[model samples]
Target: MNTQLMPSVSVEDITRAHLRLKGIVLDSPLQYSHRLSEIYGANIYLKREDLQEVRSYKIRGAYNNMSLLSDAQRAQGVVCASAGNHSQGMALACAKMGVRGTIFMPSVTPQQKVKKAKAFGKEFVEVVLVGDTYDDAYAEAIKAAETNGWTFVHPFDDLNTIAGQGTVGLEIYSAANFPIHKVVMAIGGGGLSAGVGSFFKALSPETEIIGVEPKGAPSMYESLRAGKIVNLEKIDSFVDGAAVRQVGKINFPIVQEVVKEVILVPEGQVCATMLDLYNEDGIVAEPAGCLSVAALAKLGDIRGQNIVCVIGGGNNDIARTSEIQERALLWAGLKHYFIVEFPQRAGALRDFLHVLGPDDDITHFEYTKKHNRAVGPALVGIQLSDPATYDDTMKRMAESGFKTRAINKDSTLFEMFI
Candidate 1:
């Protein structure tokens, strides 16, 4: 392993980038959240970067890096790989600078995002969907950039990109009238966290900077723990924006130095937070956007403290709403899946149904296989009106003489049948 120290990014770089982005990027608002404050017993402020032109902070870094490109570099054009947000950012930046851009996105990129990126870039940008993951697309993009002699606009890692992203922290501190004790941000390739963490450490030295990652994809956390960049063999892309195999080499040191702590939140918790943001605040947050907010649940007591949660993006696919709701319910213990084998006798289902509490509702029922005068397995998905009824409901099922296996507890069974 190389123990060499890379060049460090400074507040001067961030301030200079902020000046460059003055009229180009919107100065997104920082608003206080009454509901969140009440729930957490803290003065909660949300930095609404989701409301930016590209509906994410990605534009800041993308445009800043491209704008600084020399005339020859711009003429040769630029190429990048992104799952969604960065692609849109680059497309919009290309249009703004009148530069031709090529974006390589994973085939798994949501339709909503692909369309948005193309729409933003219009004639200035070309979108190519290749590979199943962002890493795959990234490799292809690098090859194309090298072969074509085009500037490869890294989504993160580059000093210019990090400096551009640091402007978010500048905005947070500039617009904040009251003192901010802490600022929480979601970590992907560590661009946002590194940028924001560096800014706070430089300007607001007393303020704590915290980074959060999806529990399924804790690349940053794991990397910091191992004292090097660790590539994850697998990750849950449910939170696509933050699901990175490894943190950027350039950004890792900044994160380790400035970030006080890194926390991992379960994907289900992120889903539930997204739902809460939508229902209570009329805010539609993508899974990654909800990372900072979800960390509030893990913080035991933050009463009377002033904290800022950066909501990163709102590029959520409408098609994922149902899946999000299901995950939220499961996380809340309001939904459960069971494989129940019933005796080969008449009224067996009726008997099983009778055991279910009145508050329990049958959401899904399907027979996995047909049986002739023998016990057969049936899949049952039950939704509880109140989560507290889960224990009693399970007790009733156990006493009903039916062989019931809770699929939620058994990962193998759940993955196979559910």
Candidate 2:
């Protein structure tokens, strides 16, 4: 709890980092979001770091850290661990800086991310697939660096990386034409939040800095509440980029000092935000990228104030779209999965179909045991035109002598059947 134990990162450092990043990383746009503004009742601006060179703001930190490496360090090479974004940034930094680099990624990392990191580094970086979690891969990367005498480029812990990530705040301040009331961003290892929060606190003292985390992986939020760093035993990796088990040691203190509030949003809400951005504004954002905007719904009123939401990355895999839509629909209450026990008679399905309202539609149906003679359970997924109709339809189905068990509330069974 002693702030004196940790070295402070000044606004000067972030300013210098911003200067260092010029012509190297993209000075991403701070554009007004009409759709979001209308939905949230605020003058909403999106800091589009998703459009950065590596499709993330990570390159700013990775490049800054690599650029500052000593000649001997550069010659010795660099190593890092990441699930996706950071690896791509490091690989591209190494390629551009002409330094050899090795990246350790989780074995479960998406194939698209692995391929992009490889393509970015070309011959300069080597990708090593390691254990199942980012923390597992991080430990392996640290060991690899120690064994090879390579300079390890931490994803978020180092002061230089935090300062580099802080450049985002600098750009946001410089680009915003109106007075900014609040800034919102997603937190993983806390590097981006630490950096941006520090810079904004020093420069725009009145602006509130809000940090958001996925509810399933609320390391920073819980840590701040506990007055110390807290490591989670399990995390939901759906928001892979921000699903960190623990916040960075070096960055946590900065977050505690500068960030005013930390909010947690459900993964389903993040998915819904991603879908909205893509469908409404033609913006493609990964789950973590949607976290900032997703928190807007939780904020009560911002009618006259100006708010900035940092869209952190856009490295989403096309293959995850169906799952994302599924989660979004579930969050919106438009979709429900049920296990229905049907009688052995010929009119069983017909009776069940009659229970559905005119707007109710079956999206999925499968007999769990069609060969069973007496009675069999059917896995049925239904979509409602209006979410409000769900309760009424369920009540009608129950009254009609149909036996049904809702699996949507049971995550284990929901995942298994739906």
Candidate 3:
């Protein structure tokens, strides 16, 4: 790739952005992760962007972009769409700059984030909950900006936004005591990756830039493969912070040129990483926040190398804990759901229990008795102490002559039942 063909967001632009964001955004710590390093056999460092006041690196971009607005533009106010983090950043920016702003967010966004955004903005911003996804909110936001004649603060597409986000890379490069072999980060609309990746490419040219996207929403991954921006028809919104139908037009080309690879991690794996981060590292990372670390397993042999994983945000809602645990268990194969047909006789359930391993436990059971039929279908959820015993459990069920179908393997059934 020719450096000349790169987008206008140069290292100088990022440096200027760094200066603009100096007092506004925290110089988030770059702390070494002993647990991660011991596990991966690599010197793993975590760029703690989650430590920022908004608990995200988004403040860098949002504040920088808003600060550059002209006097007229500031008076006219600003509009933006975000899943969560950017909204919080913009909300804080609006309050500090004394500029009135309107923020549109997906209805599915975590309530905790929505409340935080409002609290940060106080009287300076209006929160509008519309649509089901970021793309939908973005469409509505764009229309509002045009109709209201307000300055639109793009979450990830604008040059100023990209440059601001690049400050993360600038900090990493400056703070690192040793050479960084790789830097991994989550890609939403590609702003962070494009910004950070470009900085690394220009400065520490040897350091590999790797971007991670949820497997269910691989907008950037698909775009890179097609050699053009590709808009996805649908995406799993579980990783709301990073899930997007399309990568930003301005952010796409820069990422293509600077990023060495984009890894698609399963949403389940992201959940598992979130749990691990919370339990082991005392890090409360949102689903998207743990994406970079979730992807470390896929990076094959990084032993004895210096690596950095950017924890994007700590805006995780405590309400979603049960869902996150369920996802992690499902991904680890420790949990299974099934539709089991059992005879209506009183001893039928007891007989079925014999098929389960000694360590296996039933987590869920729902059954409706059928008056006319000899057998009735029961929804059963089983959790195993060891995932390796799954095959044995299934074999036992087969040998026991019970009619059973696994719901975990069927997406349609899993959604309808689980």
Candidate 4:
């Protein structure tokens, strides 16, 4: 653990970045969210970075970093690694500036984002699919950049990148009619949080800065608690945009200094939030994009408080919707998976069906019969109308003359099956 102080990006630096980004980047809306306000009983505003041309705030930093490159550097080109959003930003930047570049992305990155990155950059950017996570691709990008002497545009952590992200806070402050009580945003590599937090602390000292991270990939959350940077051994890459094994070295110190609190939101809750945003408000937000709003439940008694939640991006792949809904259902306790021993005799399955309540429906079932076995284990998935009835349902199943084991309740089984 290193306790050394790192260079900070000043408010002046962000203001200058804001100036440089004018005309190049859209001033994304700071729109009032009526649905969220009613639910949380707070005056909630959303900084819709998802509405940007590249559907993310990443363009701010990517463009700022690329724009500052000297003519000689631009001619030599640039390199970067991103899960999705940042690559799209860099791709757009490469095309807009006419700079040839290479973008490395994880193999697990959504195809929607991969296509967009290629489309945005056109002939100027080469998209390379590397390992399974951003960190994996980052290593390869770093090596390639070092070998070729190309300018490496870091996704987060660089002074210029932090400054560019800070402009989001500047815009939020400028557009708000009331004094902001709190500013909530997602922390990926800590660039967004560090930049915005620094600006808010300088201009609106009383306004609290809250950083949200996926519980499965709590790099920033763990690092802050440990009082230094702590690299994670593994992470759930479901929230791919924010899923990194470690926060940027430069970003950690700044975030540690400026952010008032950090919240760890479960990946399941993030999925639910994504569905809510889509179904309720007609908003299409990616998983990481929903992190800030997903964290509102953890913030107690924010009634009437003027809050701002930055919606980071909207590059969601339609194909992932089923998985997102499954996660959401599981998190809400409305879904369950179980291993059940069923009698080989006829009518056993029909008798077992009677154990479920009227509102409970079987979502999945897999069974294989054995030649002379008295019983066989079947995998069953059930969805309930009310989570409160889970215990009652389990009790009924136990008394129904069938052996059963709840997969959802067992961590090992949950990971293996679900």
lDDT of each model, Cα atoms only?
Answer: 0.90, 0.91, 0.94, 0.93
- Over 1-418, each residue of candidate 2 has an lDDT whose tens digit, in order, gives 6767975678889888889888878899999998888877789999999898799999988988887899999999999999799999999999888999999999878788899999999999999999878899999999999899999998899999999999999999999878899999999999999999998888888999999999999999999999999999999888989988898999988888899999999998999999989999989999999899999977778898899999999999999999999899998999998998888888989888877889889999998564956788888899999999988988888898878999889989977866
> Which residue pairs clash within candidate 1?
none
Off by over 4 Å in 2: 368-372
Q: TM-score, each model?
A: 0.96, 0.97, 0.98, 0.98
The order of the candidates by TM-score, greatest first, is: 3, 4, 2, 1
Per-residue CA lDDT of model 1 for 1-418, tens digit only, reads 3425654678898999999888878899998999999888899999999998889999999988998899999999999999899999999999988999999998988898999999999999999999877888999999999999999998988889999999999999999988899899899999988888888888888999989999999999999999889999998878889888888989998888889889999998999999989999999889999899999877667899999999999999999999899999998999999989988777988999976777688999998555475799889999999999989998999888899889897879887976
Which whole-number lDDT from 0 to 100 does residue 363 have in model 1? 92
Deviation (Å) of 367 in candidate 4: 1.0
TM-score of 2: 0.97
Predicted structure 1: lDDT: 0.90
RMSD of model 4 against the true structure:
1.5
- Tell me which of candidates 2 and 4 scores higher on lDDT: 4
Measured on C-alpha atoms, candidate 4 has an lDDT of: 0.93
Cα lDDT, model 3, residue 288 = 92
Q: Considering every candidate listed, which one attains the maximal lDDT?
A: 3
Tell me the tens digit of each residue's lDDT in model 3 across 155-264: 89999999999999999999998999999999999899989998998989999999999999999999999999999999999999999999999899888888999999
State the lDDT of candidate 4 residue by residue for 1-418, as single tens digits.
3535567888899999999999878899998999999999999999999999999999999999887899999999899999999999999999988999999999999999999999999999999999999999999999999999999999997989999999999999899879999999999999899999989888898999999999999999999999888999999999998999999999988898799999999998999999999999999999999899999999999998999999999999999999999999999999999999988889998999987999999999999886678889999999999999999999999889799999887989888877
